[model samples]
Target: MEIKDKVIEIIAEQAVLEPSDVTMDSTLDELGIDSLGLVESIFAIEEAFDISVPFNANAPQESDFDISSVASIVAGIEKLVAEQKA
Candidate 1:
């Protein structure tokens, strides 16, 4: 499966929604994803991509972050993958 599809699958599974309900522009908050769900989704993404997302204590909260959108999540994963390859 493509990275985008994998991301959608992970988000769908984590958010307890159908893949069809998730669009690249869909926001996680709109999907009813709470704090814990965000963490789980992050972990799932890490495992799925085999890349560790660096955690920053001063980083914005998931609520404050804009990773709710599928496009944003894909960009984040792509960034991580690029960093790993560097």
Candidate 2:
């Protein structure tokens, strides 16, 4: 599957929502993903894609980190993938 698809799948699974319920612009907060859920989702994404997302002290809330929308999450995943490949 494509990056977007993979991202949506991961979010859907983590947020306990149907894949159709998530859109490219859907926010994680809007989907009711809490802090722990966000962490779990991030870890799952990292493991799934074999990438590590560096922790940033100034980054947005866990749920907000590139998770404001599916598109953003896909972009984050792409970046992580690139970093891992590098």
TM-score per candidate, chains pooled: 0.82, 0.82
Root-mean-square deviation per candidate? 2.9, 2.9
Flag regions of model 1 displaced more than 4 Å: 56-58, 61-68
How high is the lDDT of residue 28 in model 2?
79
Candidate 2 error regions (>4 Å): 56-65
Write candidate 2's Cα lDDT for 26-86 as tens digits: 8878988876777788888888888887644346655334666778878978987887799
Clashing pairs in 2: none
TM-score of 2: 0.82
Clashing pairs in 1: none
